[model samples]
Target chain A: MKIKSLTMILLAGTLAACSGTEEKPVDQNTPLPEVETVEDEAITAIPDDVDDGNAIDGGSDDLSFLEILDDPTSPLSNTTVYFGFDQHDVSGEYAPTLDAHAAFLMEHADLQVVLEGYADERGTPEYNLALGEKRAIAVRDYLQVLGVSANQIEMVSYGEENPVAEGHNEAAWAQNRRVKLAYSGR
Target chain B: MIRVNVFFILVVLCGFNAAVVKADLTFVVTDYVEDAIPIAVVPFQWKGKGQLPGDMAKVIDSDLSRSGQFKSMSRNKMSSKPHSPSDVQFAQWKRQGMDYLVIGSITPKEASRYSIRFYLYDVIKKTQVAAYTLPIHRRVFRKAAHRISDIIYQKITGEKGAFDTRIAYVTVEKRKKRRLYRLKIADSDGHNPKTMITKSNSILSPAWSPKGDKIAYVSFETRRPRIYIQEVATGKRTRLPSFKGINSAPSWSPDGRKLAVVLSYGKNPDIYIYDLRSRKFKRITRHYGIDTEPTWTPDGKSIVFTSDRGGSPQIYEVAATGGRAKRVSFEGSYNARPRVSPDSRKIVMVHRDRGSKKFQISVLDRETRSTLVLTSGALDESPSFSPNGRMIIYSTAGTRSRNILAAVSIDGLVHQRLAVQRGSVREPAWSPFSRR
Candidate 1:
């Protein structure tokens, strides 16, 4: 049975590889994932932190000075991004925060992080679980666009189980539906 | 019309009577009983030693009352309490307008055992209907009472009873900024709740094995969701294959040899059949949308699940052997968590009521293709069918606590609730009749 399943996995991998020749040929052991579109423009700072962005980017781009992560004033300090009701799209407003975090992650390539997704207590837990994953994936897509490697992010969704605010009102729900960036060992 | 209230002096016993070690859950009930088969349950004559461990009559009476089928005559209304049919005055009960009469006596045996004998009588005909004497240990005094309730229910309704079955649920509480999740199992009446797993992580979607000896659930103790199967008797756990992304919603197949689990493989979630003996997972559906909450039809031919392939979440059916996925629900924009009845005629699910915009429990008739909402809660989810498929138990927004477990008859006539003292409970899974 083990051999049969292994053979089936190999066949699936081979079929996926053959169906998408445009996909990277380097990895034939897995299926081709949806390619993320990386924006060509450099990262932008939130309007309120234009002066701070300049001072942080003044050095060589290759340098991995991650001091901005500890700086309370840096936009990178805001590790969480909130979502609207039943929405997974990373809003245009959160782009600056995502970009700053992505730039920091791109410089610190040796470090890895986990994007933890969550949802409010409105919907069924299983459906909310998938919604949470979609929320995390949206953040992951934005980070990839800012040049963060996909391998550096691991997504874990808590669904509606882990709630920051326990109230049953919309104020609590809005705070519950979110994704937070946390450092990972890998 | 005058409303009647029933009071039961509940007894809390320790240790499990059957497969568990210990037990915690508190329950109070609110029911609507109108024109139910009026019956009288005379307190069983327990004249033995130090306070009988538990009241057999209270347990039996409570079961009948909550079922919304029989309204036990209030104790204060009964002018005479009899211990047997020979001692019963049928004219007196008939005068009180009770259709049926119940009388019993208990004899305590040495070493914490009881010889319980009970009877049901037709007051109008003055004929003895049914009698049973159950020799039981004090540990199983309540279980024995439930056993009597099951027999009485089956005899009067000519159908199977689910009073002796069990339900598994998940509880979550936030303490000191940390979350604690626990999976618990208890009697059908929400008594003797035994903790199966307790940790400072997230646990959800607990499903009982067909034999009622094991369970499958998703736990996040490792900081990621992974499916695990645990033995109810020994509390042994075995983790299934965890992929890169999500590994949640593990459901046991009816025959108990395979599991219908949801796996994302680091991308889109899909349903898969995992064979326990072979330890192999065969992916069934391929879609970009989230396909989860899989439940197998009792016939084991098809799997009904919730999917968002059509923009909004809806129920879909896919052949177990791998085929095209067909949408099966059209009543509303959101219908999920489908649990097929044991008889294969109806399906209970969590549906968003189009008018109220609240998630409620609804039943769909397979032959008619129509849906009927059964609950009126702001948020109701995780509906599981009783072994007989006559009732559905789910967790919903609670008036007793923040969240509580509730049950309703398939006909939507009766309602019952089980609440804990602290935290909240969700994801209730009812066990099949323990064939043993």
Candidate 2:
């Protein structure tokens, strides 16, 4: 029963997926500069008291912003950013994925998230702790560049203590080195 | 809420709950010096009935053998057993090419007390070099055995022994989908495991105070890392104020007056000395880069730490009161988390050779400015000096992907592993010599 509950907790994110967002980049592989103007409607979400009641299309055919994040295929569902060994810089490939989260966090001004960072089992935990924070900050800086509020984000590092994959191989390590976005109050 | 459980996989051991004795850890001597001193520690005679509380002589023998300096003779190989110097079998032991022989007896005393007596003889010289009778309660018979080993070790080697000391380490286990972390203390030989603290989150950097009475470590109880000083005996802990950012890699000063803590006030982590009595913190370094893993010198003069101010991560020396830092390690691109020797002349640290992915334990002689890589593991880290500065106990990957604690003599001639049945052990901190 306990095992089932923990699995359920982990899969909660994926199960929240349902449909697509309103302002997703037309070309998922488009350059990051073009991705900036993709969220032009985010101006309406700037106010602190913004609510989900202002759906762009309350029509029977349209999905809400939260519903788009709930969609498994939506870019907002890609909350984790993977990194190379000992490297903390966010690469170009993660632009679209992070851009989508940045848009959602801006729309829901009340939502807060903890960016939990981690490292593989190669280096010392102390250095890895520092490295983990750097990775999380990399993700946070990207969000801030897209105009996400500082109060809407928090950061924590687990270093090499917690593992989503329990192995010493490259495949497992590739999964361990990550900065995950944990949304509060789903 | 979307909370991805990000974690690094470590150690695979199949040690499920099973029937066992008190000792949760055991020693397996992997490499022994080919020409170690031939010593015979005969099984001490037990006078009381219903079996002795513990095997006193065996503990002493294991302690000696673990040092990699003595090669103990097996009990079965001995022709006869003697309890005192009067049983002169010096000729027989010399025939077996034994240089030293230790004999002892455990006799019941009044009110649950036991009179433990031991005799150490130089078999080559045919003379009894040392003998002592310890009046110890049966409850402390195991500790008495370690005390006996210390006595014999000091008499022959002329160096203070660390057999009576303890080691603090952190172990993590996967309970279904949850990770359980534990802070454990054990005998120097990795026996009699005792848990000082346990939590569901990560616990990093368990460092022993100079006096060995208490320890400071990092725990993530509130889902954020913070430092806590814990009393080993009482389990009482006081958490340092939760700063804005990371508070970790705590090292107690030599005099046990202050602590060197790595604190990041939402900026780069820097070393700060937190005074215990005044509860005031003084920033020790002003740098825009990472400055952490600060360890004080035995003389309490300078604090050596790992920093990347120069470029790559390397060991640097700075004044305890704050000053311009000088680099200490130059042999490798990666050198951090240095633990100084008892003599204050040598430092053991984790080193990654140039153009290499593996991290091994290496010793740097500050006077000569030379480095010697010890263990040849793919990833050997958390190098801690034994109290006598003869051995280094560190964490290394074990067989089947399990991370276990291993010890190597300073010269790298002898090696041993503290085998655990389950859980991945890391960040092992060998305690200072005990006052007892």
Candidate 3:
């Protein structure tokens, strides 16, 4: 175990340098030029009620905007987004709900939400944990694309440990494999 | 009269379950080899002042039977209780269709110490094959019995016995609305069980130190998974620094100086080694795909882990220090949680059979690269090999679906299940040979 530690130190430095250079090309190729246009469009597209930042008199207060989360009929009420087995893709079915959440986060900068990813009790625990994280990160990326600040989104994964349904059937598994959009400090 | 009185009390306390005696736990061989060697272990005569520290003969019988190597003769059929070769009951045992006989006596010597004399006899040859007198502590009398079984087993099978080792496992129980998780350690025969930690959260992936004095396990008490190493005897634990993401799947090096763990503080779950002496952490695998469940090779030169870099999860091996990983499994679409045998000649993992769509424990020969499925359960996983590499203990969930711990011989000849009435037990990690 000791014989290779010295070489490993050098390898890590080289790998870090390699990753640093790889990111530069992608940042220069895309996303930089459109950042201004996307932000301006997102600001103009905000709802009239949330456009006003006043909290008192039932205006665009942080609490008033959060009321959208509590409304049963609102798209923000859909806290869970289900995924196929071993998949992290955000399907089209959840696009509207996620878009609602992205718009809400853009409207309320103080609102911080945690995306807790989970998997069913099937694969190995460690692998499931990675899969769960992948699901959360995929949602995080989608929110980022919608102009939601990355700092407002916290990602966590419970893997298959915290199952909502205890049954081993497909119905229970489907319910358990999901990403829960848990809002805090509401 | 005294022996009869004590025996009666034990029988009643055991609820008339003749198959089990009053030990912390008892093992029943659910299956065994068809032509196992039959042997008779006479109840050890107690010439001491008080009752014998433990039923030594019963332990030996259970240890040997659990090994899938011997079929112990029922004690009720014994024609005589012999304490030494001079008792001369070989002819009677041979007539009972037994190949060997064991006899012993426990006599007190000094304060908290006793002299245990035992002899192994070849009934068919009518000769005593092995005999020894061991001075044992009253507290470790059961361990002495295991050591005696080990000696006798080595004499009979020419392979060192792992009966004196230990196993660490996690048990989960639902109480009201909360689930209780406990990290526990017990003897190889499921005796002297000690719970190291109990919490409302979860504990998983327990790895024993090379010396069997410390254990490394992942605890979710802090709300996120983090690795902790605790001294088994002292119960003192040191939780490693939690990174931004997961800090799980800890495995100890053969020299006990470092641990190979899976850390996802980066963008992906990767392998890292934490130095115990220097308190330094080094990254081993750098991949975008999932890389976890790191296990050290027997030589400690390389670590075999589960990686999905090639698309799906499979076993891979890389140097103990950071390096490129080489794929190790190819027969299955899914194989993960790889554990190497004591000799590093075989690897066991949770294998998903493509045809049946069932997950079972599968063994792969490192040399031959041939895969053999060792279990039939729908969900069999967390396989750990015995110190002697003769048996594997794993967790299995059946159709009715309550997870439990089970052990099978490497050859799949014998099988046994270990569980309590309630609670689910999983992740059985066989400890190395006992230091004492």
Candidate 4:
């Protein structure tokens, strides 16, 4: 049985490596298949509790909060939060999304997330790195005030090194100054 | 009518006589429109050396040639090689159309030590213009050549020369997998490069202090870039107050008692002053936009920095105490890296011409409000004035992959290129006047 399991792991590694040619070199040394399997099991078990528990009676029967989160048409899945240039202070307009994300974090205590901060490409590279860090810290502080555990979140600052928009115009600058939240672990 | 006719004829006759006498005694004033001095540097004779010293004559020849004030004759055209002014045949040099000649001899003084005596002779005057003997180690033959150039320049132009000075630059070289950045100190002609700091991170913005004993540069060693002052002679380094956020762009005050830098430990990037005597950092500018690249005026009374607070990057001057800043550059859309002249009456900066899409060195006369363009090269940055404030050393690149050091006079007449074998030589900070 152990030999069979080892063969399955090797097959999974081969499939992951074949996904992207640029990422194949990094995948060869990383144990990504094992981590993926654990994540898959956790995601599959979350829906079973939502189907039979208070989530069914807490809202419309057919359109539960969990159902809205999973549906692509729902506003919760399409929400995008904006931050000020070189600032992480949740603007008054973004407070509603912050409250929603805070409720989501409270409902799923086991979910670990990472907040990545970025800056526009105006200042020096060194100064921008520190600015991005402060932006991420500001967002993390707001989330913590909303009762998210500090241990469940990680912060990283990419500075001006990476940009979502490549243009040097004002529209691109506004879009590049942002913090992105991504689920990292179960 | 008859009297008027007589008067006109008399005047014409007198004017004709005067013209004839003036034509006969006319003296051609060649000195008023003289060209650059044409010189020939003969190879030095070794007196007491086991292995003859390096070609000191070639070093001196290149040094003088790069000044754009002398035309060096080819060695093959020389009629004879001389060791001193006495050995030089002035008629032979004059026949070759050379105006001046330089002769020298090297003798071994002791172990690894040598003495060089050289003489500069004017062929036209048939006399020795200057003579000097330099005692130095064998490895310093190039330096001896630089000192000779300085002596000859002072004798010719009545101004202190910059050949003997040194420049501190940041060198970036790639190793196997990582890029190695170093702060290097070398002669102004790019010789004897000594790596002061070698790390895997990027190092930028090297500024020499007033005394030329220490240098301030920004290094990314702690994963975040910070400023550090290092003594060039002793390699002793001290980190400045990094505060809580970002600290960089350190420019030393003329008095050397304080450093003007940009700190964003506050919410926005602003200019700050750090007192070296009291070890206290004070915020100087409270702005929402970026205020960086601080440079002190020669008198230490004011500071000039680049800021986008005016809706674009422009040069602004603020009092050392720091309240309100007045806009100094109104012509260029992008004018950064403002280096005030030693005389404190002008500023040399990198000015971007938006229409032509070129960045060149420009001089701004604070008194006249006039701007003069200095270079036609594309992508010219980092304009640093020589100690005399007559010339500027900047970095420019062509189709080549790396940037090269270029010098241009303030009047836009003298232009020359410094030859450095290394690729990508940038951010040249000219040292202050050397006491030695």
> Among these predicted structures, which one has the highest TM-score?
3
DockQ, in order, for the candidates? 0.14, 0.10, 0.11, 0.03
Better candidate by DockQ, 1 or 3: 1
Candidate order by TM-score, decreasing, is: 3, 2, 1, 4
Candidate number with greatest DockQ: 1
Model 3 agreement with the true structure over A1-186: per-residue lDDT tens digits: 323433443343343344322211224233322111112221122122221111112122345556677889999899999999878889999999999999988887756677888998886777788888888888998999999986567677788887999887789999999999887645
Sort candidate 4 into its docking category.
Answer: incorrect
Give the per-residue lDDT of model 2 (tens digit) for B1-436.
Answer: 1122222111111221232135656777777777778999988888888655666777888888877778789889999888867886889999999999999888898899998888999999988889899999866666788889999999999998889989999887879888788999988866668999889988989999888999999988766778889999899988865454588999999999999998765456778888888676677776766788899999988899998777678999988887678898999888988989999999999998899888899999999989999989988999999899999999999877778999988888777877786988888999888886
Candidate 1 DockQ vs. native: 0.14
Q: What is the lDDT of residue B11 in candidate 3?
A: 21
Cα-based lDDT at residue B306, candidate 3:
95
lDDT of 2 by residue, A20-132 (tens): 11223224354322112212122121111111111111112222445665778899887799999878889999999999899888877756677888999886788888778
What clash pairs does model 4 have?
A: none
lDDT of 1 by residue, B110-218 (tens): 9888899999888898888899888889777778888888888887888898888899998887698877889999888777778899989888899999899999998
TM-score of each: 0.84, 0.85, 0.86, 0.69
Scored against the true structure, residue B415 in model 3 reaches a CA lDDT of 76
Model 1 scores a C-alpha lDDT of 0.78
Candidate 4: regions farther than 4 A off: A1-186, B1-35, B175-177, B354-356, B397-404, B414-423
What TM-score does candidate 3 reach?
A: 0.86
